[model samples]
Target: MVARYLVSPHGGRRAHPDISSALRAAAARRRPARIEIAPGRYEETLTVRGEVELTAAEGPGSVVVGRTRGSALDSFGSVRVHGLTLVGREADAVGCHTGTLTLDHSEIRAHGGVALHARPHTSVTLRDSVLAHGRALFTGGTGLVERCRFTDAADNAVAVLEGARVSVRNSRIEDSRIHGLRVSDAHAEVIGCELTGTGKAALMADARARLTVADCVITAVHAEGIMFIEQSRGTVDHTRVTGARHGIGAASGADPVVRGCVLTDCRDTGINVQTEARGRFEDCQVLNSGNIAVFSTDGGAPEVHGCRVVGGNVGVAVIGGARGRFTHLVVEDLTNTALRVFDEAGAAFAHVRVERCSSGLEVRGNGGTTAEVSDAVFRDVEMAAVAIGGQSRVTLKDVTADGGVLGFGVADEAQLRVTDSTVTAVSGAGAGALGSGRLIARNLTVTGSGSLGVYGTGSAYVDLARSEFTDCATAGASFDEEAGGQVVDCAVNGTRGVAVAGNGRVDTVRLRTSLKVVRHAEKPAGPPPQIINIFNGPVFNGPVRDIQVAWGNENVVQNRGENVRNENENEADAEADTGADAETGTDAETDTDTDTDTEGNGSRS
Candidate 1:
């Protein structure tokens, strides 16, 4: 049997005048006790040491327990408080120390301290309650907070520290001065919750904390919606973050896995991974980001897969010696480059598609930067589909670029190797090498170019083999202004202009069908242009011999045998140097001007 006691402010029959007298009488009993209080104000602190239940004779908001200092209610054993309002001015409203405390349908408010505090070895359950200030769970404190409201917190709404385990479900934490939920060196699970209007990040996990958040909405935060730092690890799935500074941030070696999340209208980057952090984002959508959709810097190596980024300034950026692997990514309506890798960074992209962007992929650095793109498609890009500069090296295989201003733009001593790629419907040259850049293309095809199909200028070099150029408005292959290279076993057909034209040295061997070389009249003071054509065409095998032509003041055509025909007017000073080998030549001139663009060079922003 349980002992029952009634407490009333006014003395009555068999009724205690105050709660202290009733609790004193119940303490003498050997059984559990129940204290029923009338609807009035109780201005005293209480401590419970045995099994007890405190109830209001009426319902919630009918009883008020107010204190000026210290906790209004402290529990050392099993205690239950229902339908009562506990308010404290300078201390915690309710505290549980080495005991179990259950609060249901109650209101706990603190003016200058925590609203609810659970010390080590304590278990607290807050259901359908409201916390005005904050709640803290220290080491070894376990709790369940369900269907609760945490509002106007002086600090973080809920803080779990020192290995505490807590679960918050179906709760609303809003208007927090700091983070809505902070976990340090602990484990927390937040499900089906709403965290809004926070001063800082909505959820922050640091000091190697482990967090699992699912089906949550975090919006209108001042900082990152969710942040993981200091080697913390977590999994956030099916979460939506809107109107935050940054949607998610991981730094200082933190490695979190975020999947199936939507981040929209972020003030900055949707996902920021920095400081050697290696996070993985899968099947996520970032829309209308103010800046880059995903940014990884400072040695951060993030893997983004199956993600869609729409309406951002830049889709993904990897710089500051960081590396990233982005696969199956679709980026659209970006104002800048779809993917940018710089500052000695390295990146690999496969099965990626970029559409309606200013530029497709850019790889630039002082040195030691590399990028590989394979099985990628670039459509409707405003600038070059692939731009490489600043001594960076890039390779493209099995890639297709359509409806771009330039297919590939290489500059500033950069090296680009393209194999098994196709460039079509480009407004500028299909591939251009400028400012001492080097290009090596094999088995490549370029069609429907407004300018030359392949061009090398400004002391650049291009080695083309087994390539095909068709429907080019300008010459198929051009090397101008001291640029020299070799074109072997290539076919140039359906060109509106000549097949080859320039003032640079070119060695053409076994070119398909007929070949036309046009030399301009005005040439810079340099070595004379030379062309060594060694042709033994089985298709046109009738009486054509090797020809060597060196240009000196006029168009030149030299025939070694009587059967060969001169397609251009033979000049007096032109020479037929048959001893010159088509496979060997001196190095081209070194150009110091890095900003000069060729006639069909792509524009750089």
Candidate 2:
């Protein structure tokens, strides 16, 4: 089946058009062929109707397929255009069939209309070809481009319109005003390419397809770096994207995984997952952005792990009914909230985690919803280390809030819990040793504070068990209006042990430290509640020295606040008129406030 021909536009004067025409005729005669054109300029349109092999004497810059009124070649099955230049013309340059079209070592330049239009069943491969200054290459079937250069197309440079799977490798697609590569309802793989310039996007996925851009440099885009408009899942790995409106954006359930990439200098969110889209960024460096580094909104959950986020308005903003989880992430140097989980009206933050932020963690709530926080470390925070309000539930376990303005703030019926943790050297008001909530603190240590460690306002209850308080200006446990607390087996080594407001109660509290004056606005006409110390360590100073039990008040300090009429080595030191009538009785309701001057007593029940 060996067939041959020649096409020479100069009428066989230089062996180009004559070789092409002869090859076309031979291919039309249904014979397998190889038509090699020598170095010459062809000014006529070339067409390969049958199976033909059209090659050049040399490579791209060697053999020139010059301008013609029509296309260079209308190829069919197995039409190979290698090492040839298809220059600008008035009509379509190259139209092909559904078979394999291998275009390599060549340059396909400008055109009045379409550049290369592959038919429905064509499988094209372009290797080391330069597609520059053209309308675009429209393809319907699969296209594989390796080491190709696509530059300066007014429209989409390479449009995969219908169900095409286009894979590009080691390519440079730059300097285009429109999309560098636009794939609608098609799959694309862009690997190791430089997708840059002032284009709309380096890559745009419009429909439900899969696109993977790996080990690529996508920078300086006009609008966005890469966009997944519909249900497209794009996986970008080892890539660097900078100077774009949005580094990576997804809409309508676009699940994208960005791994090991450097996304910087983005005008908007570095990674925006919108409309039920899911994104994951692993071991990436995202910094110096104008907006939030990663913003997940509209019912999306984007997980960021082992990433460094710095120098943004917000490090990671999870708002508008979206949730974000940060595991093993380092977020520091933020202009606004490090991780803001904000919602309005019917929206809420499903889940968020600030395992360890460099500064602190701020949580806000709206519309009868709250925020939950735990297991974090705060250092040198400008404001409260953990601010919980608006009916929020914030818990801190094994947390160390060091040198913050406020260690923890609970307002508006917010709940806080600190377990096995320490708060040291903080200089602020309101909850140092303070606040109102169901504050459950166990095995806790509060040292070197400016104010009280646990102070509360309004019906707040504090339970301290095996907790130690040291070196505070105020009492170790201070309660404001109508608050009740219980301290069991706790050591308070401060200026005072307990200070209670009007009608406040402290039960079974052992104050081994000083028992100072409880400042009341007006001494209650009725007997105020007392502090019952069960297992007394030692009365370092005078106990309840400011109390006058003569005004219809009787038993102040009981043995264990248990029973009366029993002398169980638990003595109440009331300086009554008759010191001889001070009998040890098990009266649990005794209004007698006792100061046990006798120290070193054991087992008072």
Candidate 3:
């Protein structure tokens, strides 16, 4: 059985005049006690020892317990307080040490110290209560805070440290001074909570803390909405963060997984992974970010999948020797490059779509940057769909560039290899290599280009094999200014200009019908002179022999007393300079003429 005691300000009929007298009277019962206080103000502190139940006779907000110096309530055993208001002026409102304390339908306020403090070996549960002015500290205990309101805290609303375990549900922590919830070297789970107007990050997990935050709203935070640092690990799912400097950040070897989250109107990057941190962001939406939507730098490599970035400066940036992998990503309405891999970084993108961006993808660095893109689509991009420069190596497979200024641009000692790709409806050359860059393309299709289908200049090298060019406004292929390459088993049809035009040596073999080659008037000043080797002379419309043009000599070789007329007579002379037999179609030996095949069968004599 339980003993019951009643306390009233006016002592009457089996009632104690104060709660202390009542508690003292009940303390000798050697059984569980229930103390009911009347509607009055108690200006004393109470220390609970045994299992005790304290209730207000008139319900919540009717009984007031206040103190000026010490804690209003201290528990060393199991205690339950209901329907009361506890206030402390210069001390903690409630303290639980090696005990279990439960507060329901009450208000706890402290002016100087913590509102509620749970020390080591303590268990605290706060349900449907309000905490004001001071924070709740759990140093080494287990706590459950449900349906609570923490407002105007002088410091972090709630802090879990020193290996404590805490669970906060359906709570509102608003207008906090520092972080709303700080977990350091502890474990916490926060669900269905709203944290707003915090001075710093809404929730900060550091010092190897483990946190799980789900179905939470973090808004108007001054810094990162959720930060995981110092090798901390956690999972944030189904959360929404808005109006923050950065939505989520992980640094210093911290690796957190963020899924099904929405970040909107962030002042800076939506997700920032830096300083050797490796995080994974999946199925998240980042909208209207001021700068990059997803950024990984400083040896940090993040895996992003099934994410969408709408309205940002740069969609995804991987730099500073980081390696990132992105798949099934969609980036639209960006003002800058959709994907940027720079500063000796490497990245791989698969199943990506970029629409209405300034440039689709850019890979550039001093010497060690690399990128690989496959199964991608670029639509309505204002600039080159893919740009490579600065000694970077890039490869594109099964990619489509539609309605862009240029399909692919390679420059500055970069090397690019493209296979099974299509460039259609571009305003400039379908593909170009300049400034000592090298381009190797196989099974590529270029159609509806405003300029040459393929272009190379300035000591660049181009190797095209088994490619097709149709409906190009200029020549199908052109290499000039010491640029040279080989085109093997290719076709050029429906071109408005010549099939091939260049001043450098280009080897063309096994090309399809109506093939034409035009040499420019200016000759390159080096060895390996300008030469066009047409194997098996019957492949052309007329009987034409292989033509080798020496430096300072403009001529077309004659075969069987017939001249292969130059299509553009104003550009270069077509007369035979190398004496050949009019009947046998054999040319005289010259120092530069190294052709050993005399017969028309494309074999050495």
**TM-score of candidate 2 to 2 decimals:** 0.75
lDDT of 2 by residue, 2-32 (tens): 6755554555553434655575467567877
Candidate 1 has an lDDT of 0.79
lDDT of 3: 0.80
Summarize candidate 1's per-residue lDDT along 1-605 as a digit string, tens digits.
Answer: 88889988987888888777787787778468899998898988887768888888898888888767777888878889988899877787788986899999999988888888889889899999999875554566998999999999998989999889999999999999998999999999999999999999999999999989999999999999999999999999999999999999999999999999999999999999999999999999999999889999999999999999999788988889998999999999988888888889999999999999988888888668989999999999876788787789999998889986678767778899999999999866688776678889998889998666887776778888999888876567766666668888887778365566555376777666343444431122323222321111000000011111110112224322222324563342233122212222222222121121112222332
Model 2 CA lDDT for position 231: 78
Q: Report how far off residue 185 is in candidate 2 (Å).
A: 2.6
Better of 1 and 2 by lDDT: 1
TM-score of each: 0.86, 0.75, 0.85
Per-residue lDDT of 391-462 in model 3, one digit per residue for the tens? 899999999999866787777788999999999998666787876788999998999986568876667788
Provide the lowest-lDDT 10-residue window in model 3.
536-545
| Candidate 3: residue 103 lDDT (0-100) | 95
Top lDDT hit: 3
| Clashes per candidate, residues 3 or more apart or on different chains | 0, 38, 0
List the candidate 3 regions with Cα displacement exceeding 4 Å: 513-515, 521-605
